[model samples]
Target chain A: MFTGLSAFPLTPIDEKGIDKRAFVGLVTRLADAGVDSIGALGSTGGYAYLSREQRAWAARTAVEAAGTTPVIVGIGALRTRDVLNLAADAQSAGAAAVLLAPMTYQPLTDDEVFGLYEAVTAEISVPLVVYDNPGTTHVTFSDELHGRIAVLPKIGSIKIPGIAVEEAPGRIAVLRAVIPAHVTIGVSGDWLAAGGLLGGADAWYSVLAGLFPETVLAITRAAQTGSSAAAVAASDRLEPLWALFQRYGSLRVVSAAAESLGLVNSPNLPLPLLGLDHAARRELEAALVVLGLN
Target chain B: MFTGLSAFPLTPIDEKGIDKRAFVGLVTRLADAGVDSIGALGSTGGYAYLSREQRAWAARTAVEAAGTTPVIVGIGALRTRDVLNLAADAQSAGAAAVLLAPMTYQPLTDDEVFGLYEAVTAEISVPLVVYDNPGTTHVTFSDELHGRIAVLPKIGSIKIPGIAVEEAPGRIAVLRAVIPAHVTIGVSGDWLAAGGLLGGADAWYSVLAGLFPETVLAITRAAQTGSSAAAVAASDRLEPLWALFQRYGSLRVVSAAAESLGLVNSPNLPLPLLGLDHAARRELEAALVVLGLN
Candidate 1:
């Protein structure tokens, strides 16, 4: 039911734990920026580091702050039962929909992959978005597999990452051609929004929108209204931020950007992933200035 | 404290849930074959396909049938918490040791990989084996990371797969040289046992042992007891089974052999992975006949 720019806010964490105030503030800011929807516990939100209980709390907080805006909660886990559990929690917390990724470590055969989605979708009462980010999750769904899974009942949309910028349009075309008219396709990058929209993606799942939400919203509105010049202008201004986001190549980069914007106190990532290095921070600062986001 | 040939038996499943009676029978048969230990719910044992509750039941059943012989429970999972929980269940069920692989799916940084193992090992009270099967897990423990994790208390062994045959000796040497004396380096493969043992591996984890445990046990015992002639003879006799197992490049072939021997009925695998094809089944039967197991 949601459209336009959907901002996936960076989860704020400090030495004590998840900074609830900062997270709530972030949700409020994105809502004011005209974000069509907000997503929590996504890759940008560092869902892998959060406990199930923490994820549930974050989902609730985001949904409450989002008010009338649709809140899509990412429900990714390695096991089918865990994913189902998260979906139930998200549904209980009043999330509008749940974004699901395939099992991360164990590569499932096409049949197994379809079966996993079927199992998860069957358990949840909420609308589902089948997230395809094979770069992080080693397993990828083929076009045929995606086509089969799209026909399932509860699936509402497909979220495809924009890293494969050139391939994304074709991928989106394949998905659009197969999935019914009711199903929407969302792009997960800023730089490819113009091309993605042209290729049939219904909306943008914007990470940069967390920092400059209005700019992305304007671009999405312009693109949807068939104003090519307005969409290009907006995309041009956001390109620097998009490049910076790509430089770090990890989820922590989004949090680092949040810290740079003073939206969060620290870029303190959970153990295992080190915070952004000095060079990366400087690059981010330069890009922020270029995009007028600093 | 146990060593030599260890067989990870396939979990039997007929139309009626888990075929516990057939599983117990298979264990009893392996015990009679002079197998030194039993590995349960491991990759070969279809741990990924079984539900968590089913996994616990299988572990318990295997432990009950194992008696005094050591039972090494496989505790691999995508999240550290799940692995820890599995380890606790395994310890409570009386498993002798726990074997775990690193987080798969997302390409983990070296630090994340090490952190995952440390988190699981810290919580486990019993001895644990770090099972490094990069082929399936898509993540490898570098020699440096292995050395760091090997120092942890209760860390007892390393299971290096045979695909890295050439590197096995060097890796074993590094682990042996750096880790405490109590930490054993073991190799998993039918043909690499002799070289691995010669290169200082303390034991072997063999799939062939499920079908021809006597032959594998004899070879390992002969090698351990300094009977080169006996070891060579035993290895020669087990060659056909090894060749058959390698043909399909999957562990299901081993399960098919178990079915051929009447150890378990119906080698019906879970969704995604089909059972042995016609040619593979015939080859397994032929190999079993040649190995005198028929």
Candidate 2:
């Protein structure tokens, strides 16, 4: 169900709770820009840090705001029961699909990993996206496991993390070969989106799309049409923003960029991850000007 | 406030939830063995996988069963507020101290790391142990951050992950030099316990101690008395068990060993992490026999 340029918005939170209005506005903008899908409460959305209630609210708010745009809500947690609970909540909140990441405190065996997604998929009617973000989840989706998960009932897509810009095509090729033809392969990580699209990923599950859906959609369209020059130019234009992503994570940089562009209020992200540093903020401002984001 | 060999029990859960009787019995056994402290919900206890309510119950149960043995509760979480909430729960449950690991979803800066603990200590009356477990938390405690955390007002101990068995002594030496003398330096990860104790660490925050408290105590006492050969012999005796640890993490192996010894019922650990594999079980059985645990 998740395809093309899906925008994963940073969940903007204020002291009172999730800034519902800000979140709704963010999703509405993406929908207005005609993005393919909306992924709320993904890593960029801080699903891991928010309470269950807040996450449900995030899903509901995004879904209601996006209207016709399909919304994929992240349902990953440290426990299986928790993931199942969140998956059920996502369905009730009208999410288009629920994303599952094998996020466990202990190292999960291949069987155990499959069983986690299988258990959740059994309960929910919505398609499940196996989020293969090894960096955060600490679980590697071996090619074999990918094939195994792909065959399970309700397994719709596998969201692969993007490799270096140049390596995306090769990574996509290997994944496409292993996974069944019907299973959509989406690529995440804002910096990896252009490469992922050019490399033949079924979709770009993007962070930058949250702020600049038109820019990401342009890159996706250019790459999909085999317009290599156009895709390269679009990718090069965002190189400065990608530099900010390298210095800090996309989540921080994206939040700062959005704040600088006056697209949203200054967000108070969950603690232990502070706002962008002064140098980072200044760099973001310059990049925003250069990219005409402001 | 915390020192010596601290027994960290795996919070055995059954279908009915935290096997309360089994949990209390295990802590009682540690107290009966005259263990210095009971670390009820450390990583080995599966704190990350537990619900807040379950964790509070674990703390209260261990503290009540521990009698005079000081009880330390693990209060790590992805968000600072959740950590504070858990810390408060720990205090109300009569824990002697709270262990805080910067268990964040995103990479935390040193300032952010210190801020998390600082926020917790400001509210709680109990001491805090800086849990520096990089393997799980994904946040490294630079030596500078370690020194800064050690000097915090209510910080009592710093539980450092034991490096490789051979590297334990040097790791302990470096940590000891940076952290103040008053703040206890405790080493966890059973494989490095012997070397940690011998290298002048104030305590061995141990996993095996939860089951074989006397064995761990024997090793600790041996090291404390300058009996290096005896300590090495004691550690070497458990090499087979350590091999199991190398294969599967301590949480799984320790839970399996406990079940094999009939110390607790066969635990239904939180999913995505299964019980020990057959090979691991057989190896654990042989190790138990060798160690006279069976």
Chain B alone, TM-score of each model?
0.92, 0.96
DockQ list for all candidates: 0.26, 0.71
lDDT of 2 by residue, B1-294 (tens): 476789888898754588787888889999999989988888888899898999999998888999998999999998887888899899999999888877866777888898888888889898888888888877788888899888888999988887676777777788878888889888887887888787778888999898889989999899989999999899988998888887888888888988887777875577767888887799889888877878
- The residue-level lDDT of candidate 1 at A211 comes to 63
Q: In model 2, which regions exceed 4 Å deviation?
A: none
lDDT of 1 at B34: 70
Query: What clash pairs does model 1 have?
Result: none
Model 1 / residue A27 / CA error / Å? 3.7
Steric clash pairs (candidate 2)? none
Residue-level error in angstroms, candidate 1, position B190: 5.3
lDDT of 1 by residue, B35-63 (tens): 77888887777676566688899889888
